[model samples]
Target: MSEVLTTDMDRDALNNDGFRLSVISSTAVLLEQFSAVYDNYPSYLEIFSPIKCQCGKLPVNNYPESLQKQIQRLVNNITEGMETQRKPLVMQKKKPPPLKMFEPKIEEVFDDRKKRKGGSKEINEKQKLVHKYKKEMKGAIREIRKDSYMIAQVQFQEQQEKYASFFLLTLTVLLLLSMGYKIKWL
Candidate 1:
């Protein structure tokens, strides 16, 4: 077996085929040994049977008749114990309390009236302050708008002056050219 596995071949091919064949031969030997040991055994079925079903219950059908009956009895006893252990519910009649309207005391009402009078004065003062601030904000915004307008006017005037100067220079050049004056730069 070792000679058959270790022959001269490509390293990758040898590794794959050699490992596969060795595993297959080993599994075959194991299965043969297992079968020889259990083939004629009388309790082979009980030995190899599943201990529990897929749903986690004991495999009662796999067991002998007497054990199956005992398991059923135990299961019945456990279910009865669970049923008896539960608490019983009791029913009773209940009455809701009557509703009542809230009424303020005389002294509390007088105190609240006094607070309202003071609060009104404070509210008037706050309103006056808010009006003053609003007026100041409007004046500031107006001044900002006026300044931006003046800056825009100045920029427009500067651009107009630049174009006027350029036009005058071009006119002078054309006049000198028409008069047949040989300008050295030209």
Candidate 2:
């Protein structure tokens, strides 16, 4: 129930700062009049009670009928306007693309052995090619690791050198200050 109320509030024009300001400004006069009447009769039901208005003894009795009618009209108009102005800003959900079916291509290789001869030579050659590819891949991976390690070491050395230079400069400045060299810059 609270969630529903919150969602309604979120969609309300009064929640918008600019729209709320405009509505407040437009109803300033009505609000002031309502406030004055409200001051006498704090309860909403009491304000509309005929008994309260009919009694000439009470200050609330002075409340005019026309003011009540006007307030009612203003409230009705504001609610109608709010309903008309509310437009859904949320976008519609998109439908996903249709699924596609992919069929793998099947192939048959014919060798001399399939007929009546030997195919051992071809099998040996293919195996050798596979081993050669595996070795090349391993060598490439090892070289990449070595290059990365060397780069990291170079960066570390550079950082160390920078810190060392800064330390030495600070030490020299401290030594000079301690010796009372009377340097103009110091």
- Local distance difference test, per candidate? 0.59, 0.60
For residues 1-186, what per-residue lDDT tens digits would candidate 2 score against the true structure? 456657765577456656754554455456445544554333544343432333223232333565445445545533333343334467659977779979888898766653433358888788778879999999999999999999999999999999999999989988999998755764
Task: Give the number of the best model, judged by TM-score.
Answer: 1
Q: Estimate each model's TM-score.
A: 0.32, 0.29
lDDT computed for candidate 2: 0.60
**Which pairs clash inside model 2?**
none
The TM-score, computed over Cα atoms with residue i paired to residue i, of candidate 2 is 0.29
Which regions of candidate 1 deviate over 4 angstroms? 1-119, 182-186
lDDT (C-alpha) at residue 98 in model 1: 68
Q: What lDDT is reached at residue 28 by model 1?
A: 38
Error of 1 at 129 (Å): 1.7
For residue 112, give model 2's deviation from the true position in Å.
24
lDDT of 1 by residue, 30-86 (tens): 533553465455543343233112112755566557555544544443333333333
**Ten-residue region with minimum lDDT total, candidate 1:** 47-56
